[model samples]
Target: MSNSNYVLVLFYSRHGSIAEMAKFIARGVNKVTKMDVKIRQVPDVSDTTTIASPAVPDEGAPYCTLEELANCSALAMGSPSYFGSMAAPLKHFIDQTSTLWLTGRLIDKPACGFTSASTMHGGQEQCLHSMMTPLLHHGMVWVGLPYKNKALISTTSGGTPYGASHLANSTNDTTLTEDEKALCEAQGQRIAEMALKLQ
Candidate 1:
């Protein structure tokens, strides 16, 4: 695929909710003509020094590479909430992108964030903000869900003006509410449209 035409849906999911959200976001991106979506995930971080993650994941999306990241026309990133911040694994992957930052490869590319939390007050917005910081530092334009998206105002589970979000409940349910899905799609579509205009 041509690097210039695709949006990278990069994420890290612990209980799979974030991954499911990535799919809906990709579906929204697919609605736009002449644009494509690439879903990729980062490997889990291990605490043991001797442990090493496999080059390819045993299941789910393949690991993302720096090249794929630098070449995307836009980016949609997600991660499960970890203490009011992004999970360590996604942050680990992003920390390695100093190469892209130094060269301004992602400069002006449209980007958005998505996240999931186990409860209504589980720091979903803070996690989204954490994810957006590195993107902003890379000179990428940040895109956010607007109140115009009816779901953002109506959602009880997880929609936010900051970005798409999901309330996973304490049981860690991965199923997205209708409103959550709608906001995710809107976020995706908005980023894709913005990417095209910037191109």
Candidate 2:
């Protein structure tokens, strides 16, 4: 299948909560018949210049390539909060997309963000915004969860108008609350539906 047939679900997770959220979002994308989802991850970044990550990861999703990112029909980006910002690995990967930005390859594509934080007030929304910044610069259409989803109003854990989120607690719990899962799916489904319409 062509890249345009799928929604790219890209994320970075340190303690696994963000990865678990990606799975639920992918489930929502699959709910849209004929639309596919691609789950990819960014490699860990290190301060030492002598060290490098492997070409492929040993577990979970493979590291995303620029080609995969540029060609996707739609995008769902997630990350664990880092001092109210996105994780460095994900930011590092995105920083390399200057080529795509120059080419406007992602222009008009539907996109959304998701995140996980250690606490309810741990800057999940800020992390989501950090993820959306580059996409907006690429001219991608931002897709966000609306108030119409009951989960948004009821979720004490992590649903937001900006995007789906998860409160991982201090233990870094990977498990999502019922509302968080639902909101994740809803965001994915909405992005997929938007992608199809754009096509």
TM-score of each: 0.95, 0.95
Model 1 error, position 104 (Å) = 0.8
* Clash pairs for candidate 1: none
Q: How would you encode candidate 1's per-residue C-alpha lDDT over 122-145 as one tens digit per residue?
A: 999999999999999999999999
Error of 2 at 130 (Å): 0.9
TM for candidate 2 is: 0.95
Candidate with maximal lDDT: 1
Least well predicted 10-residue stretch by lDDT in candidate 2: 44-53
List the candidate 2 regions with Cα displacement exceeding 4 Å. 1-4, 48-51
Model 2 lDDT tens row, 75-158: 999999899999888888888999999999999999999998888899989988998888899999999999999989988999
Please report, in order, the local distance difference test score of every candidate based on alpha carbons. Answer: 0.92, 0.91
Q: Model 1 RMSD to the real structure?
A: 1.6
